[model samples]
Target: MRWSIEVFFKEAKSLLGLGKSQARDFASQIASISITVLQYNVLGTVKRFKSYETIGGLFHEATDGAVQLSVTDRIWGILQELVMIIAEAFQIDDERVMDTLINRSETFKHFINLDKLELKQAA
Candidate 1:
């Protein structure tokens, strides 16, 4: 248990930016820590579902621009495009569709980050 805790802290410091905050205010420090923990949790979920055995390995893959998108990445991109295409074809509002998807469920919102998705209509 202690070893696991140490490993987690090590990864948090090195990869997750846990102790890298320069904020001087208490609230800002707390916010920074919270954000770091949230980032760590998201990465942990990715590591669990993906083939990565270490957070470092996952981070490397995510940051390496030379690496080609995996099938899952390609599928996600296609899904985004499909959503836009469907909205255009059906004369539906793209932002409304995204808002619906994002507000529909917490799990969907968490996985897709739909709020951050910028839907650009094809001109």
Candidate 2:
């Protein structure tokens, strides 16, 4: 029990900066401590659900999962797959199909942010 308390204090200070607030006023310091405790509770809850062995490990894993592809990347992937399917169906070169689509469809270009130069490179 004592060891667990020590671990909590150590991790709370090291990971959450529990006492690092430079606020000179008593109320501000209390608020800062409250925020730190809240952060610790949130992380603890996540750790409980995720079964992470240590606070540091959970912190790193949580941060690593934050990265995601943007809207443009998803749209570009869908467009590439569609172009490939059309090329396969028509027995035409992918580049040729892509050129035709880019040249003729003003709406497609406007929606997808693709140009002939980019289409050439992508194909």
Candidate 3:
């Protein structure tokens, strides 16, 4: 996931023709937001579980069964909006940035689907 995000950032930077420092700054911000969203999703899931067993049981349930699903989705939306804002700030192409964001999001979604499939098979 980290690698995918890094790749997305690099691709976006290259497409935008940003300098190394500016690209690094933008990537850093994106990474920070991603980490925040991940942490929120994890913590939110933990909070939703009444006990360890319930938390463990999450893996056996559907991907969308987690209480943090909606929150994570919202976070992703916010991240995309932020990327658009950054593109505007840098005078880069919004469509290019949006495309990169969408690609990265699709990659993440694929992983989520794979996890759900694995969980279903296990159960």
User: What are the C-alpha RMSDs, in order, of all predicted structures?
Assistant: 11.0, 9.3, 23.7
Total backbone collisions for each predicted model: 0, 0, 0
What value of lDDT does candidate 3 attain over all alpha carbons? 0.61
Q: Once superposed on the true structure, which residue ranges of model 3 sit more than 4 Å away at CA?
A: 1-69, 101-123
Taking the tens digit of each residue's C-alpha lDDT, what string does model 1 give over 62-121? 668657888978987997888798899999987787778779979877766543454333
TM-score of each: 0.49, 0.48, 0.28
For residues 1-123, what per-residue lDDT tens digits would candidate 3 score against the true structure?
999567545543443222333335767767655654554446346746746543224433534565665876899788788988999999999889877765789786686789899999999
lDDT of 3 at 7: 50
Q: Which stretches in model 2 have alpha-carbon errors above 4 Å?
A: 63-123
Arranged by lDDT with the best first, the candidates are 2, 1, 3
Query: What's the CA RMSD of model 2 in angstroms?
Result: 9.3
Error of 2 at 13 (Å): 1.0
- Cα shift from native, residue 15, model 1 (Å): 1.2
Worst lDDT run of 10 residues, candidate 2, spans 108-117
Q: lDDT tens digits, residues 1-123, model 2?
A: 999789888998988788999989999999999988887788888888875667888766766876967788888889889999999998989889888997899997785565666788988
